[model samples]
Target: MSLAALLDLRGEPALVVGGGAVALRRARTLLGAGLRVTVVAPDLHPDFAALPVRAERRPYLPADLNGQRVVVAATDSEAVNDAVTAGARAAGALVNHAGDATRGTLRFPAAVERGGVQVAVSTGRELPMLAQALRERIAALLPEPGTVDAWAARREEAVRLPGAAREGALDALRADIRSAFGLSAGGAV
Candidate 1:
């Protein structure tokens, strides 16, 4: 079975071994996760001009994996992507192999964040269409931002209360959970 988890990988060093559309997508996701990314390729996609990643106008070298904790093998060349996967694995870094997702240790999920609520869906083997469909379905089910804010405030306050008091506070919050998003008092969001 696959395990789902939320990780805090901020400020970690990462590498992307491509510069095409696939590389662009992977780079954006890595950047969002707070990873300091460096993309190496002899040529780059036109869209890459807008991203804040470190760009290297050169071919990928195994030496590039140095100090990287995360790697994405997103080049159009399968051989290059495979090499990236091997190098990253040997370096003990989590790798996302775009050419063959199952061969890599990590597969990025399609995600949606709203009102501080994050929903992610992953379909391994690079089934992006499936993952995206599920992500959209889940996003449509999210509550309004106000409901999340109310819950967040309740959580913050409850942290200072005793166990019994905290339970009571949480119970009250649940009873009035409609506080927003598409949620309703007598119906569902």
Candidate 2:
């Protein structure tokens, strides 16, 4: 499934089954979203030593999957990734495998961030390269950072309105924001 389709990682426990660049990148994203993260590997990239999360230096064990809400297997070895995926699934955790998307329950998306707005793109596991290419194109078409901040402020104001009024006002504000960005009304900003 698409990354956006999955549950939010905020306040959840996520496990990364590697400590290389790929795993580090994945862990960074999860941590950015407020997930509690644990990195398991024999060695970690030097950059990880400065992060505020837990890092366990060791081989992967099935017990590491316990109490995790989401798991990302980003080891260089496909076998290790697959093993982690299996263990994660058995523990009822959603998993994303960096080596092979089809081997896991979820796939990461190429995302663009603007203030409080985040637009993500994915083609399931069918064409990640294509999705990434599209993401770059979309990024180029986005508005300046200030515009996104203004939109977020408007959204917050809209949220204070009553039910139907909130929805209607938010929709209009969203349309105006998209228009200012030269994006289609229904397109993600």
Clashing pairs in 2: none
Across 1-100, the per-residue lDDT of candidate 2 in tens digits comes to: 3335645768899999999999999999899889999999999999999786799999999899989998999998889999999999888898998988
TM-score of each: 0.87, 0.78
Candidate 1 lDDT trough over 10 residues, lowest sum: 180-189
**Positional deviation of 169 in candidate 2, in angstroms?**
7.7
Stretches of model 1 off by over 4 angstroms after superposition = 159-165, 178-189
Q: What is the lDDT of residue 117 in candidate 1?
A: 90
Q: Candidate 2 regions off by >4 Å? A: 1-6, 146-175, 181-189
In candidate 2, what residue range of length 10 has the lowest lDDT sum? 1-10
lDDT of 1 by residue, 1-189 (tens): 467888899999989999989899899999998989899999999888899999998999999999999999998889989999999999999998988888888888899998789988987545889999999998888876777887878878977899999977866676576543345555432
